[model samples]
Target: MPDLRLDTTDLERAATGLDAVARALAGTDTLAGDGAGDLGHDGAAAALRRFAESSTRRRDELGRAVEEFAGHLRECVSTFDGTERSLAEGLGGAA
Candidate 1:
């Protein structure tokens, strides 16, 4: 039961982290564009490239965290199902 709670907490934290990363990426997008067409070509290019790299790394980290959390959720579900089946079988129902 405690383990389940911990897993849930971890999942929540991971989700929050992803949300922060998404917001950061959005902010970067706003900076990457030059609304007045006054951006120096080289500087704009460098800024865009840097933003892209940072966004990519953040996205990858989020993806991995989500995948790990999903795996834990799957395991928990399977365990719960097995326990339910066992209980049903003990109660004389086909588990």
Candidate 2:
């Protein structure tokens, strides 16, 4: 029989990696704080807070998008592997 590879371990790892990255991004957001500690800095504090808010928002969106893309890739790999297995089984049974 011909070799028909249908491994999905890489895709699964990539999905996990994306999730980890998302979690890391969230961690950074948490670390940014609300600028409460710099309350005495006036303008600088407000500007920093604003920058942090926008950065957190963009990071969250980006992380979510990457996770979603990774999920899609994993699903596709699963479908492909399942289909390959089904085809192989059918052919084996016929033979």
- lDDT of every predicted structure (CA atoms): 0.61, 0.77
**RMSD each, Å:** 6.2, 3.6
Instruction: Compute the lDDT of residue 7 as modeled in candidate 1.
Output: 50
Candidate 1 residue-wise lDDT, 1-95, digit = tens? 45432354555566566556555544454433433235557777777767766766776676666666656666665677678779899999975
* TM-scores of all candidate predictions against the true structure: 0.53, 0.73
Model 1: lowest-lDDT 10 consecutive positions: 28-37
Candidate 2 residues 15-67, lDDT tens each?
A: 88988888887677444456545578777777777787788789889988988
For each candidate, how many residue pairs have backbone atoms clashing (under 3 Å)? Answer: 0, 0
Clashes of 1: 0
> For candidate 1, what is the TM-score?
0.53
Who wins the TM-score comparison?
2
CA error at residue 5 for candidate 2, angstroms:
5.6
